[model samples]
Target: MLCLTGPTRAVTIDPPVLLAPMEGITDRIFRSLIAPHGGLGAAVSEFIRITVAPTPQRVCRRDLGPPIGVPVALQLMTPDDSHLAASVANAERAGAAWVDLNFGCPAPVVFSKCAGSALLAHPERIARIVATAAAATGLPVTAKMRAGISSPAHLRELVAAAAEAGAAAITLHARLRITSYDEPATWAWLAEARDALARCARPVPLIGNGGIETAADIVRMRAETGVDAVMVGRAALADPFIFRTAAGGPAPTVAEASAWALGYLDAIGSGSPKAKQLVRYWRCAGMLADPAQRQALLRGPTPAIAGFFTSLVPAGPAPPATRTSG
Candidate 1:
């Protein structure tokens, strides 16, 4: 486990890896299933909108559900100063290990409200919001941002601003606002941001995100960017064991992968994270069945999905154990 020793909160993060929060995914159940299997250092919740009115708080209670195995960060995305501060304090009350400000979400719906990447147009305001959250609660305050709003060149200034405002760490997703996943993430941009922090003599950590799809990509992210940590995105959903495998944890067998994926779906209950994501997961893991079989698995009942996954594994020895457990 890697310990992030911020001024107020010192969080122990195992394997120095993080899960990038996905809007519909990355809910309570998703965090529970992944952290225990290995190599999950920490995870942030899906971005919670901090509006003019306070929303109901969601906490991880021991009796109601499985405990997430890593430091849990509650993420807040908003353009309102008071709302941001208030939400951070509420997250502290909800037992969040840290509070994360989301300035990196590129969704047009989010940006339309002057939040997310839209704030990149005003770097000083970004600094102000981070400073507000840090002051509002004793909880560790971190920020996730993109390279820039329109151009990657603007990241240097924003990185410096976040550091000066006492963000415990910064996560940089290497894409401009206008770009989509169709454009490749520029790892050089992350290096540039890290170097900027270094030049300032600030030991603030940088977490790199985007464009990772394999175990080797995880290694490359840390090696090339000089980042303190990395967040796995769609790739993690595709292969739940990628974190464990990349961290030198045991390689999961076919049965184990299916088990982990099934466990994740079951924990999800019903809603938000549709079971269709599992179809993509199967494809990503190169486990495509025949056309009729794939259609049946994807479109049939939930029980069928489970049966299909289970069928992938014949009678074999159990896979390597995950380092931790729910």
Candidate 2:
């Protein structure tokens, strides 16, 4: 276990289980909703794309706001080393407890611009990027990378370079960029990455990602790979309580969980149509405790929906759905 002291208190993460910084998913609203569930050691900010143009203050405010009562790491994606370093500094100034370099995003638009997973093809560049960001931000710097470029050999090189770059930690998503969500994650590959990191003798922690859904899955992965941590992404969206379960805490009653979700929507405010739209999307995606209640909330104007979802608290788990994944 590593203990890091922040401005407010000391934060300890042992075999750290983290929340992935997924775009459009882990915003302030969601982070606040899930933080209280307990088990997660860190929540990463959504990837902030750094550009040659000057960053707007509001952009920083929106992305790098105050910590959500939990250790929050800011993530940045950019092809330029200097630009990323500057962005990391700005995030630190804005109150980021840690920094994450995103080299695992597989979006075609991102790769087309030579950002994100495209950097996987250049292990040397990946090392340079990690070195630059780590040097720029005195805080712990981590990197998230894909399994490899086109072959498993590439992943070995990637892990070696990241270790050489002084990364405080590294996470492998267990699949190549071209592999879509439909395919099962290659658990063996993740094991290989862990072994590679171990052989390097770097003291940095290694985290495994991809295909983890339940607490059982986490336990299995840790036992199999001997990694320092496991990251939960879509599974968290399905059930924020997974963290609690992983930590061996009592699961929140359905009503209690619903109330928490409502509180999150309330925090975001329902006064604006845009805010309402975001809430509605979250509701339809089964984020709310009660699906029927969420629909009824949307019956009136946007504000009404916000009010309803915010005030809802059913007595038990919502009706079983045809499909569920967390």
Candidate 3:
């Protein structure tokens, strides 16, 4: 178990696998669906942008919902530190276990506004944001960041800034802002960040992210980067059982996968068009490899799509649909 020291208490994450925040993907409904599979130590909400005003408690509650299965860290992002502390307070009131600042998002919409990875170019601003959040609440304050915005020259400085500013833990995505997801993540940089954190007066845990897919990848990342934990994003969407499989657990049976898909459909509501789009990811990765089956799933009616998934299960009583929380 990995113990993260919060201001008021320590949070222990067994298995040490956290769900990384993905913009359109890791919403409340998705978090609930993934909870039953069992592999994560914690989960992070999608980056909630705090602009001119403090984020409302309603917004935080909508994103966080009621704590379902695991502690969910409320992640916030902003172009400046104006309302960061207030936002953190709102998150605390809304039931966040801890808080994480987003300095690693690479989307152009977020970057164009000087938030997310754009903050990577300004270590001072990152420090101020972390300091504001650390002062605002008793929750463990963490920062998620890339190596740098456009270059690696300021990597150590950025890491040092957050660490020195009182961040309890740091998650390194290990890719520069300019890099594409297709590019290989430089695990070597994660090692460098680890070394820099060790030099701090109070060395905190480091979480390594990016390019993690299979159980083997999780093993390799921990061995190579020496991070206290590992976070998976895209991989989790493709395979909800990733955390389970990483821990040497068996992959889901066809019926089990079908039940997972149906439960997710129920959570999103059968009418959502998104329900049709998500089936591609909701299935265990590569389970729908047949071209005909893939097309059938996409072209089928939304309500009837559940039947297609059910067909994949063997002849027997259907697996019970797992209940999902909003």
- Return the top candidate by TM-score: 3
Model 2 per-residue lDDT tens digits across residues 1-326: 54433223344665378888888778877887787768877788899888775344467668756666677878888876867767767777777777788898889889998888999988889899988887776677788989875666688779878877878778889888988876888888877877777788565567889988677798888889887888888777666778888888876665565666566556766564445545454422245657775576566676665455445564467788788689
Error of 1 at 167 (Å): 0.4
Per-prediction TM-score to the true structure, in the order listed: 0.88, 0.80, 0.91
> What TM-score, to 2 decimals, does candidate 2 have?
0.80
lDDT of 3 by residue, 1-326 (tens): 67777778567888898999998888988898887778778999999999879999899999998776788999999888788888999999999989999999889999999999999989999999999899999889999999998888988889999998989899999899999988988999999999999998878889999898777798899998898899998888777888888888898777787777777778888888867667655547457767677778788888888777777766877899999999
Clashes of each: 1, 0, 0
In candidate 1, where is summed lDDT lowest over 10 consecutive residues? 58-67
Instruction: Give Cα-based local distance difference scores for all models.
Output: 0.78, 0.74, 0.86
Which pairs clash inside model 2? none
Give candidate 1 regions above 4 Å deviation: 55-66, 269-273, 283-285, 289-303, 315-326
Kindly report which residue stretches of model 3 are placed more than 4 angstroms away from their true locations once superposed: 280-285, 291-296, 299-304, 315-326
Worst 10 residues of 3 by lDDT: 277-286
Error of 2 at 60 (Å): 3.8
